[model samples]
Structures are given as structure tokens and as C-alpha cells.
Target: MKILAIESSCDETAAAVVEDGRTVLSNIVASQVEEHKLYGGVVPEIASRRHAEAIVGVVDEAVKAADCTLDDIDAIAVTYAPGLIGALLVGVNFAKGLSLATGKPLIPTHHLRSHIAANYISHKELKPPFLCLVVSGGHSHIVEVLSYTDMRVIGRTRDDAAGEAFDKAARAMGIPYPGGVELDKIAENGDDAAFPMPHPHVDGAEYDFSFSGLKTAVINLIHNKQQKGEEIPVADICASYRKAVVGCLTDNFLKAAEDLGYTTLVTAGGVSANSLLRRELERLCKGKYTLYMPEKSLCGDNGAMVGSQSYYEYLDGNIAESDLNAVATLPIDQRGF
Candidate 1:
């Protein structure tokens, strides 16, 4: 099936055409990074406005790039939940309109679920019944991919997510917006053991995570150094912070897979693009289990992943109604608000 997917979940307005689920014929994204950079992060209002302006052009580009028209698309898929409401509405309403005009099935996709599906694009042999470590800006979860549309969260963050912690830490170090990427680059030159970091544990929940303390610790350390008229070792701090976060994430991820007897492991979402996380998983999974990771380009929000997941949703007879509305938050296990 040919699926035209639209994604305006955050600061990116993207569209793509995917065949079946694995083959992506075309992927187009319009990013608002430059505009959001001035604020050191994404501003919801600006992001929504940008999405409204770019959605049309992006979908057009995707269709043209795929060498197909609306008539050739079997379904229209869109991210409808767990994102900025206004930003999501742009894509959802546009997709609904397309489905109305083209008489195609409108598939409402969960943003986080689509992130997991990104693996299908790169690892064509990948299938369900695997463990996936999903870490992003707002969510940190260890999910069991029971099936294409059915997923269960085995573990999750109790407070700030790994990506949010990274960004906050980078901001304390004076790094610009999208701090996680910059911090990763800086961390490469420093020793991870240069500074000590906290190893937090949620008393009752073995697999659950808590990063708020770590984020506070890093920020406090930076503040103390500045107050003492001492220079901060930005690289060392980044390395240590990254090491701590990666260690925490990998510990739970591996434990879940081990406890569940899952031989196949996958990582998804924005933070899965982190060098430390990828390297650590690669080293640990070597010769023990097969590991799958999306390409760096596919790590962030995009339409291809949504399109990929849409194929499975279609197979499961999942379709959206005309009154489908965007939601600001929804669990990965839940379909809609």
C-alpha cells in the first residue's frame, strides 16, 4: 500500500510516502530549528505557526518526490496525539481533508509508536516481539513491541526525560538550543569519569527511571563553580552527564530484555541518536543479541516513520473519523484521547 504520512508533532513539518511499510519512496521535512534557536528551545506558538505554513508545501514535495499523486496513495496517515496541540492540528486537519477529497483511509498514528516503527525502514527484516528503548524530549520508555499496533510500556521515566535532562545540562553549560547534539560532540574529547554523577534509583520500580535529580546536580555544580570564580570544564561535565544518562538507560533496557528473554533489541526516538547510547548498546549487544537502530536522520520527528506505522494500522483495520482532533498528550498504549 502507498501511504502518505504527515508529521507536525513538534517543530518539524514533514511528509513522506512509504510503500507497504519498509520502503520509503520519499521523505520531506521542513524544520523550524533556526527560528526556534533564538529562544534556546522550541516555542509552541512559533512551532504551530511554522507547521501551518509549511504543511502544504512539504506534502506537495513528498508526493512529487515519490512520483505519485493523491490518486496513487492508498491511505492518508497523520500523527494526531501526544504532541503540541496546535502543531498537531495542522497535520491532522490537512490529512483529514486529503482523506475526505481522495476517499482514502485516514489513519491516526501515535507519535511515539511511529518512532518505534522507524526501525522498519532501515532494518527491513525487523518484526514485532522485540524490546525497544524509546527516549525522547518528553518521554523515556522501555517498550515491548508486541505487535505493530499493540505496544506495552515496561518501564518509563518518573520525572524529566533523558533528552530534557541533556538539554537542561547543556543550557547550564551555555550551549545553544538543541543542546543534546552539541553536548554529545563536546563530550567526545573528554573523559567520562572526569566528574562524578549521581546514580539514581526509584525505590520500588526497578525498570522505571528518575533523571530530575541528576539534572539538578549538574546545574548546581555549574552554579557553584561560577560562584567560586572557577572555570567549568564543559567537556568533562558533558561527558560525565552523558555517561550517567546512557548508563542508566542501558541498564534498564538490557535488564528488561534479559528478564523478558528477548533476543532482539531496538532503540528509537531522538535520544537514541546519542553517540554514547548507540556505542554502549553496540558493545553490550555484540554477540549476545541482535540490535536495531534507526539512522540519525530518522531519529527525530518525521513523516516516514508515521507512514511506516500506518501500513500496520491499516492492516489492523484502524482508521480515523472526520471528527478526529489533535491531542497534546496520550500514552503509547492508548489510541486517542
Candidate 2:
């Protein structure tokens, strides 16, 4: 099936065309990082306005790059939930209009699910009945993929998500916005053991995570050093902070996989791009499970992943009507187009 997918979940305005779910024909992502960088974070209003401006061009470019038109597409898939409401609406409403105009079936995709589906694009042999760890800017979850359309989250963040913690910690260290990548680079030159940080392991929920405390701890450390007139080692701080975050994520994910008896592990979402997280997961899961990680480009919000999951949704008879509306807080397990 030829699926045209739209994604404007956060700072990225993206569109893509996928053939039969796995093959991405064209994935065009217009990142608003430059615009949001000045503010040291994404401003919801600015992100929404940028999405509106970029959506049409992005979709057109995706279609053109795919060497197809709307008429050639079998369906329209769009991420409608678990994102900024205003940013999401631009893509959702545009998709609705496209569906209305083309009379194609609309498929509503969960933003987080799309992140998991990103694995399919890179790893053709990766199928269901495995564990997936989704660590992104706004979410951290360990899910069991039963099938293309069937999944259950086994573990999740109790407070700030892993990627959110990374960004927040970097900002506190006076790093740039979208700080995860920058922090990762800086961390390479610093000692991971230079500064010890707390890794909160939620007691009852072994698989669950708590990063709010970790974020606060980093902030407090930075403040304390500043008050003492001690020059803080930014690289060391980033390395230590990343170590704490990655340690918790790796430990919790491994625990979930072991408890669930899953031998195949997949990691996705924006934080999947973190060098430390990837290295640690690979090192830890090497002898225990077969690990799958999405390609660097597929780590963040994108339409190809949406199209990949949308194909499964379509196969499972999950289709939406023209009047389908964008949902701001849709649950992961709630299956509906």
C-alpha cells in the first residue's frame, strides 16, 4: 500500500510516503530547532505556527519526492495524539482536508507508536512478540509488541521522561536547546564518574522510572557550584547526568525484558539517538537479547514511522472517517484510526 503520512507532533513538521509499511519512499522533515533554539526550548505557540507554515510544503515535497501524487496514494496517515495540541492540529486538519479532497482512508497514528514502528524501517527481520523501549523527549516507555497492531506498555516514566530530563539537565548546565545531542558530545570528553548523581528506581514498579528527581538534582548541583564560586565542569556534569539517565533506562529496560522473558529487544524514539544510551543498551543486552535500534534519522518525530504503523493499522481494519479529529492526549493502547 502507498501511504502518505504527516507528522507535526513537536518541533518537526514532517511528511513521508511509505510503500507496504517498511519501505520509505520519501521522508521530509523540516526541523524548527533553529527557531526554538534561541528560547532554549520549544515554545508551543512558535512550534504550532511553524507547523502550519511548513505542513503544506512538507507534504508536497514528500509526495513529489516519492514520485507519486495524492491520487496514487492508498491512504493518508497522520499522528493525532500525545503531542502539542496546536502543533498536532496543523497536520491532523491538513490530513483531514487531504482525505476529504482525495477520498482516501485516513489513519490516525499515536506519536509514540510511530517511534516504535521506526524499527521496522531499519530492521526488516524485526517482528512482533518482543520488548521495545521508547525513550523520547516527552515519553519513556517499555512496551511489548505483540503484533503489528497489538502492543502493551510494560513500563513507563512516573515523572519526567528520559529525553526531557536530558534536555532540562543540559539547559541547567547552560547548554543549547535540544540539549541532548550537545550534551552527548560534551559528555564524551568528561568523566562519567566525575560527579555522582542519583538514579531513582521506583520501588514497587520495577519497570517504572522517575527522572524528575534526577533532573532536580542536576539543577541543584549546578546552583550549588555557582553559589560556591566553583567553576563547574560542563562536560563532566553532562557526562555524569547522562550516565545516571542511561543507567536507569538500561537497568529498567533490562529488568522488564528479563521479567517478561523477552529475548528480542528494540529501542526507539528521540532518545534512542543518544550515543551513551545506545552504547550501554548494546553492551548490556549483547549476550542476553537481540537488540534493534532505529537509524539515526528515524529516531525523532517523522512521518515514515507513522506510515509504517498505519499499514499495520490498516491491515487490522483500523481506519478513520473524514471527520476524524486530532486528540491531544490519546492513550497508547486505545486502538482507533
Model 1: CA > 4 A from native: none
Stretches of candidate 2 exceeding 4 Å from the true structure: none
lDDT of 1: 0.94
Top candidate by TM-score? 1
lDDT of 2 by residue, 1-337 (tens): 9999999988999999999989999999999999899999999999999999989899999999999888899999999888899998899999999998889998988888899999999998889988999998889999988988788987899989998899888988889987988999999999989999997988888999999999999999999999999999998999999999999999989988888899999999999999999999889988879999999989988899999998998898888887777777776878544
Q: Each model's RMSD to truth, in Å?
A: 0.7, 1.0
TM-score of each: 0.99, 0.98
| lDDT tens per residue, model 1, 1-337 | 9999999999999999999999999999999998999999999999999888888899999999999998899999999989899999999999999999999989999999999999999899999999999999999999999998889998999999999999999999999989998999999998899889999988988999999999999999999999999999999999999999999999999988899999999999999999999999999999999999999999999999999998999899889889999999899998783
* Per-model lDDT: 0.94, 0.91
Worst 10 residues of 1 by lDDT: 328-337
